[model samples]
Target: MQSQDVAPRPTPASDPVVDVEQAEAALVEHYPRLVRIAYLVLPPGLGRGRRVMTAHALAQRALPRGRAASPVIPAQANGRDGDPGYAFVRLRVLRAALEAGGKRRGLPKRSQLPPLLPQVWGLKLFPRSGGADELALDQQLSALSGPARAAYVLRGLEKLPDGDVRRILTEAGAADADAALRAADRVPARYELLSSPEFDACSLQARPTDLMRRRQHTKAALAAAVAIAVCGALVALPGDGWGPDGAAAPVYAQNPAAEAALDPGRLVRVTGTAWESAARTDFSAWPARGDLVDDDGLLRRALAVWARPGEKVRLSFTPGTQTGGPAGPPQLLYAGTVDNARVVILYDGLRIARYAEPKDGTAGAALDFARVDGASGAEAAAIVLDRADGNVRYLTAPWVKKAAERDLMKPGAGAMDLTVTDGITSPLASPATRAGACTSWNVLQLTDDTGTHVLSDLGELVPARLTTGRPAKEKDATGSQALHAWAPYACSLGAVRSQGVRSVNAWQFAEQELPDGSGTGDWACTRAETWRGDGSRTLAQFHTPGGAYGAVVAKAEGGPACGPRDPHVLAGVLWKSEGGHWYLLAAGSRDTASIRATGGISGSAQGHVLAVRAKEGAQAELEGTLEDGRSISGLR
Candidate 1:
């Protein structure tokens, strides 16, 4: 063991050019949420949990293999671009912590990272109040290292010219101070050439072969024809070949076999793709025909069943049945509907479920008619759409034995209803009107003032001081699954999607408050969260106990930071106005004075306010103004 040391291998002159494709794929894959990203970039000084490693893992998983080694160095490299090694280093640290028993080993999950606030102008979440100094912002940014801060700010906020920014980021080293400062000033370079795949492909000299070009032309012609025919039946069939220059093409009817199989007056049920749907029309005026075509063009055999919302449609198959089955050739019949408003079936009138090709197309939740204890003519059908292959198959429910009839009625009154309000411009409505009942769910809708209408069925609203808001959990059922109690203002929220059982919907409304406890300005909030347990129990168990309660409280200018380890209450007079500002005043005694609020008047004009009194644990009336100058009167 005397002395035989080996020399280190020389490192490559340059890291392999960051893999652009790999990096892009990674970014697309994880697609980190805004809050999740914030939890990483923002210092632990804020009330963030130890999930930075999880975030990094998600980001890493986004990239393809070998691509992760060479992430497309962000094209915009100006400012303190993130150190290429930083993310990897963090990942290593997190993995190490996890391996070492994490907290039990006394290891910090995430380093007290400095604030990598974006350098972009006008992204300040806090108002430009005299009390809130740049030093304070710097202190907030303190968790981030110098370069990390610069990178976070430029990329996250200013959204500087990324290409040049990328160059600056790649070139700047941890050792250079002046270069680092200058890097901050450099505008992100515009590399339009590499910005998009189309542009990149066009800039290259690769030319298509003659045969390839001809094939492309053939594809284009075929695509055009298909589009014409698929959209409106004007497209010529490919098998028909080319037609004389301007000669009109002839329509291709179904094969004689398929045609022979189809009959209009016979009440025949046709189950097939849009191509097969050519036999039906949309919004069919005749009750018989209308029942067949849905707005989406999905063929419905029991159209008469759903055509009249609450009507039961009875259908009989032709005398000589072809498809063999215990119940003979399946005769399409409209069964009794469940939900009242829109016509989507409800399982046992409660558990909440539906079958749609585009939504739950996997047939994972398709109903089984054959399995039904008491059956009818094809009690149900299962349509499977493989997201991977875009293929669809329809299978009849297994339980149908005999046909039965039941009265269809609308859902109960307390059940919610949805209407397109002001936010969305389109007037289209989902075919299913009833909001299926689900124990937990989130409703993400736009508010009148361009804010969000984030609601949850939290048994009932709880109490919390202002500073930040809690996320809402929404149920995931088919159709207009849930209804809104009242018709507030009209706002169009595109199709609603579920976040998850635990994924909560957060909200931030704008308002102002008086120095005393009385309410003053306009403020409204639909943010809610409910526990899965008993309704009688207080909702406190669902969130961190001894923390701020319902109705977040914050400082008028600075904030109402998280309290010390000791449990205590903090209150503030919160207010909002149509002028695009929110204010909170100390109407009563409250200890905390400063707060960092998210989801307020942002990227758009809106007003808000939150002020905490000198004492901690106090109450005050909540008030604010609406865009129409209406007063936001009361809150318990």
Candidate 2:
């Protein structure tokens, strides 16, 4: 068809505009191309099925509301002879696609939702699979930001030059068009792959969703609806029917065990002096002590919510921890008012569940869960009482006679006394909440009859215990030498926040003297062990003689290196001396008989230390021989 075949009638010079009729004509002629643009620019997290539907919806909705002036920009010279109607419709599609992938200032846009008109009922439609090259390009595009992806699509699919792409992006509300172009340049230019079936939303592959799963879901949904109706009727009858569960969800089914769990009277409260004679000292020995311990109403509400939390409750869980309701009546650890909220702590032998509600009402409640199945010793010595204003309060063990705050970065500084009232320590600055440069790390030091132990909060309900020494003979981090060992690597603890860490042990494995006689560098390995008996992280750190903090040379997650199972660890770092020369510095544990470096650089040394002259940015592989004649590879 000719260009003028669908053009609207000529208008006056003072009121030149593209009306709805002209825009619709351009959209109908170039529907496939416009849909491809939207598909490529839409966020990939929505999956291929939704991307196809949204792409079609955006292209169909690209018509102008009425008569609108086209943006004052030169159109690309590819085709259509710079048609104003095509440009107007293209800009609308591009703007809507970008908005769908990002946040807007005012109300949520319609493009963000599943397209209402262009959705399929039982069939899921997605673009056809392409070759490896197309798949790689799709992955690379997915990694780019929305604006960057739009820039790439406009350049490749639309065959527009960089200048046109930049102008179109700016006119479409992109904040930084140059930045988008720069980011697009990082992707390899495989422009031909843009026409592959993998990106063509017009020609799609259709498949029916799992029929069996849908059937099961429909049956479950109907059952739930009936149960909800029954519960609503019972609630309307009043009397003793599920009275005020706070923010908890409505009960769908009636069961004797669940009812018993919701009863506040069934909560196990320990005696104050139980730990003195108990065979095992752990959270089981924690005594019930809170001003609201006698407040039956608050306790009942807390227990009810713990059994069945509602949608309004804010819930958080540590890694690998489950959020299911309690199996039976749980133990009461603490129930009282803290700061602006009424908090309650409960332990069900496997997990520690914390429930908190507002003081004025039950709205805006929060619940948190952390796995503490086999906790004892220092690991079970303290429970977080309250966390507010970047500070934390802990209810220490009954045996803890004194509480103090110490900075792990400043080991030489004396510990500051903190007031302990009813086994609760005053608020201390939490290192997990600190931002920017981590110059200092504060830890809680609790002194009991055994000695002193240190605990650091890792953004969880329970604090992770700190220790230092060899893997076989690890001890509490209270000695001067142990404190010094933990100073340089303390800030590195931020890497393990919210990871359910139970304890962290720092071991100084080796020390090497610099080749240029600059100074001695200490090699230390820190291992963080989680409560789930897995996901242990080990770091090999290098600390120079006069450096403020140690640098992590090598690290491994869930590896046997630096642990008791495999006490031997070897690591290397490329260091530059004050004399302006580069060298490969490597060290192994004390039991190592010799160490060697290969691949890109070669060196061999006796007695667990090796320093070889090398170039900067050179990669090398290390091997070590233990005293028992076993070989070990360097930590990656």
Candidate 3:
């Protein structure tokens, strides 16, 4: 279980030690977030010196396994940058800190646990100026046990859903995710401190303000002007979608009432200035935006999406028909949520073949730079992202390599023209334009079974250069899937080729060395009644000497999987830990179903070593031994 320091590598390019450098960089980038989480979990009462050192050590120990458990933070959360990945790792590190000692027992008694304050978590939801004393907060928190402390901090402060909180507590060495949830719910009136308004209710209905939009940005005026588009009367496009009399009308939502229903599944149209957003630096408070990319490349912006708790929103991206152009083949058209700050990105990996068939080394019409035939080729494109940063600045192509020059609006008013090619008419513009006024185009076009609807301010989609490789596999029709939304054992995650067998995302280990030579052993204990029920399931996650964890599940109520009641064997759980998280040493779950039959259960992970303990309910019972000579079963 001992860790050996890696030998130093001088240079990344000269030495070419990519793996080592990458690992080191990941640890560095995530260290701060990890420390913050560790501090929350570390038992209080230690001086500053011990508290800081312990959290850092725990974070370091967790780095490797953390990486293994979840290699990539899923791009679906639309959270602040790296929040998902760090959130995943934070739980593991906290759990390791809780289960550090050789001895495992009841939730740290109030007398044994560290100080915690409800206000610390409350500020995350609603900030105020009370500034409660550290000592007073500590005294208030001292009344709570370790599990309660964890629940208050994680579920209450982090704003994670109840389910996510439970999963984290379970992995942190709680007897089970559900039992941990119950214990957390036992925290008196804690939920009231974190309550906010209408968080869970979502309405796609268009309100009056939804029809209003910010007006033209003038060089002379520092601030933006607000304007409302006339909706009562519709004006016909001069050349298209007009009646014979050349009359046009403003379009309205096909079913505004359907959206007003406030159902989770119905699609709501977003247009004009209907929705407002905010920005935050760290993914913690107001956790929010992506930087704008110009001809000069990506530039950091002091802005982001500011979403309130329980407000779940997804941007719509539906690609149109492919007209063979002289542009590079499309590699990826992704609605980004990670790394790039949750912006839409389309990477064209220069796949020339995906365009229409070519002729004489030219993509023929697809690449016809000189287009008279309305053909297709590798055409240039642009994106316009509007962030609510006091000013209305859009994320668009940086023509002339100058971010400032990507001005979406010229003085006066006119549609912002996106010139696809030098002489070609701007590819994406409003159907009509004022002689001197700016014509703004809404980029998102939503096509449902009923009809096609347009969303304003989502950003315009045009061709762009894509250098990165496309996703290895396309996302399923169901939409962005959670990396670990369901327990890896509960259901499959995606078309991830590496899914199912063992979850290898990110993890870190806390090694606990076992006595030498006595590696193999048997537990000597009596068998308890093998009571069965669908009432609840008890699962135990055991930590390896190296800080990695493996789990075992028993479909019974009010009983521990490992303790002193029934000597339960890990019938289908894995017995090995790799890269800091438990891995299946062999095909145990997929093996014969008879392995868990009513008779004596088979198998053991005794060699890895475990310190399983139980927290008694209000009515404490005699902790009993199991048939296994060494294993114990009870509530953890």
The candidate that wins on lDDT is 2
Which parts of model 2 have CA positions greater than 4 angstroms off?
1-255
Q: Count clashes in each candidate, considering only residues at least 3 apart in sequence or on different chains.
A: 110, 1, 69
TM-score to native of every candidate shown: 0.23, 0.65, 0.22
Which window of ten consecutive residues has the lowest lDDT sum in model 2? Answer: 1-10
Model 1, span 7-70: residue lDDT tens: 1111122233334553443244223321233233333333222233333343444333554322
Residue 479, candidate 3: Cα error in Å is 42
Ranking by TM-score: 2, 1, 3
lDDT of 3: 0.28
Candidate 3 per-residue lDDT, tens place, 1-636, comes to 211111111121211222333444445544644554555455665533344555666676654433332111110111123333344455556676666421447665432233332212211121111111222343444455556566665665455556656666665666555655565565553332221111110101111221123222242243322222223123533535434644555576354443322222221222222212312111011101222222111111101111111111211111122222213222222222222133323322321111111122211111100111121111221223222211122222212121111112121222233332211222233211111111222222222232222212211122211110112221211111211111111110111111001111111111233223223222111111111211213332222232211222112333433222322423222232223333222111111121111112222332322322111111111122233434322222
Residue lDDT tens for model 2, 1-636: 011111122122212376675576568656777898899999999988899999999998988566543211111111233567677778888889998999766877798988997978888777644434566789999999889999987777666778778878877778899999999999997765665556768756455566788999998999999899988898788676656658876677577887888888999999999999988778989998888988889988888777677655655666678777788888888988888788889999999998888799997677778899999878888988876555789988888989999999899997999999998899999875553346788999998878899999887889999999889789999978889889988977876776789999999998888888877899999999998889999988888877767777777889788998988899888877778788888899999999888887888999899988888656688899999999999887
Candidate closer to the true structure by TM-score (higher is better), 1 or 3:
1
Cα deviation in Å at residue 19, candidate 1?
Answer: 32
